[model samples]
Target: MLKQAGANAWFHKGDLRRAQAWYAEALAGMRAHPEFGMEMWKVYKDLGDVFRRKGDNRRAEEMYEAAIQSAYDYYKPFKNRELAKLNCQLGTYALESGDLDRALAFFQEAMIQVFPEFNNADPAANPAPAEVYTESWIMDACAGKGRTLHARYLRTGGEADLTNAARCFDLAIEGVRQLKQSLGNDAAKIYLGDFSHAFFEEAIAVNFLLWEKRKDPVFIEKIFELMEGSKSSTLQNALQLNRAVIFAGVDKDLLRREEFLRVSMAEYQKRVQEERMKGETKDTSQILVYRKKIGDLEREYDQLLQKIGEEDPRFKSAMREVAPVALSDFRHQILGKTDRVLEFFMGKNNLYILSFDRQHADVRALPLASGVYNELFEWLARFQKPEAMNADYADFLQTGHLLFKQLFGDLAFPSDRPLKLLVIPDGIAAILPFEALNLTPPGAPPVFLIERAELRMAYSASVLTQQENWPVKTKEWVHFAPEFRTGVRGLSPLLYSARETEGVYGMTTFSGRSATLPAFLEWAPRCAWIHLSTHARSGGNGVAPHVEFYDSTLYLPGIYALRLSAEMVILSTCESGLGTIEKGEGVMSLARGFSYAGAKSLISSLWEVNEFSTAGIFSGFYQYLKKGKTRAEALRLAKLDYLHSPDRPAFEKTPWYWAGFMLIGVDGPVRHQSPVRAGFYGLCLVLAGVAWVIWRRRRSAGHSSLRRA
Candidate 1:
């Protein structure tokens, strides 16, 4: 304790060298007396901190590694909060070195350690003690993560980075609010500290970046909202509403909830059937009364659920509904055509939109006829395939010109300033690469849509409006390469997958294994980045696709059962992204299941992939990701690399190899392991080597005796 005090005094005085010396002495003293019953992990950590401050990063890392290794060797589990703080320091060191990718990775690792639920696990089942996840620690990690992403966005100009950063800030604020609500005003004050203000400043800065990019007043209003600090209360209310909505659907009486909803639905259906059967004889007043009664019962049922939610603590974070943000109230954010927001909706028969600015909403039918739009997209998907590219290019171009004219004719965007299009596509249009569409006039050279404007996608405008900041974890890769049986129908040898996995694994700390059924089930949840190079066939509605392995098959349903917790999952196989497209649920592909299971991003092929080209392109993608590129940018660069690699023929340069895969989720780089940890593992290898020599000698002696006999 005296040594610790001396180190602290030196650190506070800015005498980093003295602090390091004192910490080293403390560690040595503690190590010398094993019967003292005191742990030296804190001393090691302090030494690491002092070394880091003194600009000796190598020693700092070694000390940090020693802290973890020593604790493990002594059979003492480091408290979760301690682990988080240590990782945060490591991330800070990485940030100082300009290794933004490595920094984000460490920050994410800290976050997951703090909030295990973020890893897609039920916290109750593997609960951390209350002291293990302090409100302050969570806030710091979130703020740190936000700052890292904001820095990355500045460097890369990737909108996703800023958007994700915004989310981190929201989560920090949310954490504070949850603490305050759970512990009451007086008790929660202890946890609040300066985090609220820090979060506010960081949030304002991120919103400023977003506002500058889109020139939207909404972001500006958000900045003001932060200053006022009323948003937290509003968010808490939304949380309550969310709980009400979720609980309403659940039957309180065991199986009764489903039965009750089912009975109500059945009655409504029966009423409709009776009206149809009676035709003119049906009483319109009675039918209206019956509908009113049903509506009243539903309202009452929902109200009861809300009341129950108010009484329960567990349902606090459960979503009740999209925290209500009125579209009319949000109109002030839109200024004019230069900063307009258009949300497109594709129906079975026609297309429509809610195109608006602060002043007015141009809610009307799109001029593009249904038949033409459908036919164009169908051809577009077909044209993107390698085998049909030569024959389909002319068809694609013809349809592309018509699509360009019809889609953009009404929305007159300015040519001088950059147009930031927040696209919300539906139906087949969701997967369509709008940027690649040919926009050149009839009987003119090709000019793609991407050249005209910058595009960002959102599921709904509400997603942006109700966005709350959350912490993200470090990235790690988990790849699966399954061996296939010969003569299996549609099964072909994908030897190049091995090359792709090998190159990607070399770039980062990898958790790769054979695509056996057991291996996939075990590793899928723990890994942050996953790549599966195997045969896949997407199933129809209610039927999920299966990923084949030499030992067994992993069906889509099986994926849902596992906790994913991954940042990205790459399905490097045929038609891996295709699934039954539902109106409200989006596409239900293997990618979708992984997304549901907790994967934040996915790289899936729209069609079959060329094995050799895929290997090279995938390797290039990992290289780009390592350089701090967003998933979309990395994938784009990979395609460009493939295009320029061998100066391939025009037909080969077509969309087949490049455009087949699409990124769907938050684009964050994978986690990187520290060299210190690697060194520790190297020591383990040395011990193994010694054991192997002993075994070899014993075997030689046994062989000599056998020869004598």
Candidate 2:
């Protein structure tokens, strides 16, 4: 056991040589002893950890699996507290192995032992709410199980998985509070604090994923309070990234990603060398992570090579892969993403994209829910490698570039040359610390980086408001060509512009002559991509009219106000995702209106989107539209762009300030064809609703006159 522990310490410090020696000794000792004890488990765990560190996850998984089995056999009969800890470790390990069912089983087993001692009831069947539920241990089980359930939902989309995730989180919360009270040593319990924090974070993430990949600030509001009213960088980064993807906007996060520059390339190499010399190999728990953590170094090396090769353009390579998004003839629909086709690549091939422009230096990892598969990534590399080797590489690269630009449209080519990233939320917009990979790595595709920072927009705004101005900040003479520029007008009383009548639902025929569909509302019949509504924001406050018809009546904070049909509708409203709640009823809001109306999901504001920042946000928002990004991913990206910018005090704030915009109920990998009816009914609904608007206007006039008299 001591030898195994020594090995792990070595591995953790990045001294693979010493670690291997230690493991070899432990392995021999374990084999000779053949005992059912700590020595055996330690040997297996340490061995696996080392292999995984060396980029051998497959072998590591096999070893870990054996360790888990033996540990369980050794501990099952004793029901010891330490056994519970091992169970947690096993559960986490299984998840890393991509064996979700097995992972869930381990977590459940842990929870079973925990229930009576901590929860006072069996959580396997149902969550038992009670004042007696104490022992932070049980609460921890609930959270662990909840995490498993949430991940299962991502993998399978089973309603049971989602519901259980919610239930477990709720139970965990109840148990945590009760435990704190019973223990009478609240502050001293670091375990309780850590458990509470992790559970809360996981719960909020799960809820947001369930409700449609948009972080529900409602859950976060409570979680943030529970953990000593302080903030965790983990939570902040998760949230900021979430906002970025959902919004497709920009901010300091993009430019500050340049912080990777501060990370010395030599320093990275030096650290690797130091680890080797110290006889330790840093264990990232898994080889995948270990490699990814240092992906920048390899990328840097490749870029150096590419920069040298640039002397002769023909000597340079062209690597291209088609359909990372899977917009091929075959169809697999998830979320509402099946409607469009496009992609983005991080390489120096200089794809022809002749039809349009397509290159972004700022890239972030997509969460597990994004419609990309692990296998697909490897497949992409395999395909591109061969493509790069073709005699037609240059021709195909040019043609492919042109085709990509044409297919993706203006969004792909925001400019003819280098893209001018607009900083939002506000900071300098630089390329994502990256250079094309010169070679296809065994795992993820390689790329070089200059710097990486959890991007935050360093914008300038004394106060938040409804209008956003995005004038050209670059000396490069960039301008939105009028024909290519889009002018959108949004109107919905449930949003930022009309809070006095927050829950009110009415009609409008303001488009002129309701007998026939008005020109404004009739556009859906033509070939179009989006249905945007700049409306009011309601919900979040939990105060509303109690009107069943409008979920806004429930008045939860940070939801959109308007619901449009079967197309992509920018609620352009605020806090509509948050629903009004009655004493015993679940929350409801306009999100449902659009869901029922056949709309994919509403891109809405959680809080009021700063009006002054709208134009800039719209730019990225439109880019996503052009790129054919799914509603959710697009909005998330836009929000991220806004939060990471540094142009102004307000321009580069978090989603909380303005990037809280969310796309409700619309995330899947490959976008599907916007249902054909989207063309007809989408336009029809706007036209029909206009009359309702007029009627409401008339009634308002009458009420005003009566009050005056």
Measured by lDDT, the strongest candidate is 1
lDDT (Cα, tens digit) per residue for candidate 2, span 1-709: 7887788899889998899899888878777886736557656776777787788888787777777677777766656555556566767777777777777776676666665444333334544566325555666666777877877777787867876887788778767655643432212333454446556556545554544443444433232222211112121222222222223332345323322322343234334433333334544344344335456544654454344345433223221111112111111332122222112211111111111112121112233233223322332232223333243433333333332223234332222322222111100011111111112223333211101111111111100000011111111100111111122222222222222112212211121112121232243222112333333434233233111111111111111111112334445444444454211111244543333222343454434445445555655655564456644454446655665577656313422343344444334322333322233456678988998999999999999999999
| lDDT over C-alpha atoms for residue 591 of model 1 | 67
In TM-score terms, candidate 1 sits at: 0.47
Can you give the lDDT of residue 34 in candidate 2? 66
Stretches of candidate 2 above 4 Å error? 27-36, 117-140, 175-195, 208-709
Position 117, candidate 2: lDDT: 43
Per-residue error at 601 for model 2, in Å? Answer: 42
TM-score of each: 0.47, 0.31
How far residue 514's Cα lies from its native spot in candidate 2, in Å, is 78
lDDT for 570 in candidate 2 is: 44
Clashes of each: 16, 148
